[model samples]
Target: MSTTTHETRIDVDPDVPLVRITREFDAPPAKVFRAHTDPELVARWLGPRGLEMSIDHYDCRTGGSYRYVHRRGDEEYGFHGSFHEVRPDELIVQTFTFEGEPDGVALEKLVLEDLGDGRTRLTSTSLVDSFAARDAFVASGMEVGVREGYERLDEVLAQG
Candidate 1:
């Protein structure tokens, strides 16, 4: 069995307002894509290890919108977004905004590629409005969250 560690890549360009992440899953593209598009699956592995995620509403189709909250103890962080385009098992484009800083919105795009022998590669790009916003994201310890999230996803895949 192929392991799912040391293959995740998180890249932040020094000159651009963008963040790119690439990771491979030991599962088929369909299953991997479903994990991304499904709210229940997202909650299972989307954030840091200790936070609990609650979905207010999630619709993964084009023109659809979603809102969710992450709670850790008494503190809660809310995020909401609109799905701009969705192509099953292939690509997703969306607008993401954290509620506390409503004006900082990012355009996010994700692409899934099928690799033979039940493996999938997922690449995600987030385009912020400004360099400061992108830098803020990098400074937010996103790498740890992302790496841990992928580890959680590996566990989820192993269960099925």
Candidate 2:
């Protein structure tokens, strides 16, 4: 199904070690990349709509570290990770772990393609250690959160 806002098409292959999600954005690759690196912009669209994000630390360079918390009412979730690779306007690879569910941690890579004409395509692939880890991520409602987060990102991009 198509969405009025940006759409993320996720594909899960049981035999593959990764889950991939691809989406197109009206913004340029550089602008989209900056939205991911800039802590303020990142925080604004990092979690579910009802949740608020607070970045304790964020360093987007290679080998850099990041820690943030997602809060909704009285509940809070913490996530911390380190960047494995960073290629500005091209790709980003990182290890991501949620404190609430460490078993679901995975190595994630985001590849950005500049479609030109003020458009970009982002493909995110997360490689997990086991199928169970992947299953847990799906069961945790992360897909919904990710979609919502991107919708928020669309709004942020449109505002500027």
Q: Evaluate all candidate structures by whole-model CA lDDT and list the values in order.
A: 0.90, 0.88
Once superposed on the true structure, which residue ranges of model 2 sit more than 4 Å away at CA? Answer: 1-4
- Steric overlap count per candidate: 0, 0
TM-score of every model versus the real structure: 0.94, 0.94
| lDDT string, candidate 1, 1-160, tens digits | 4445647798887888999999988899888878888988989988789999999999999999999999999999999999999999999999999898899999999999998899888999999999999989889888888889899988877767
- Tens-place lDDT per residue, model 2, 40-159, is 999988878998889999999998999999998899999999998999999999999999877667899999998988889999999998887787777788899989988988887776
Worst 10 residues of 2 by lDDT: 1-10
Off by over 4 Å in 1: 1-3
C-alpha lDDT of residue 42 in model 1: 88
Candidate 2: the clashing residue pairs are none
Q: Locate the minimum summed-lDDT window of 10 residues in model 1.
A: 1-10
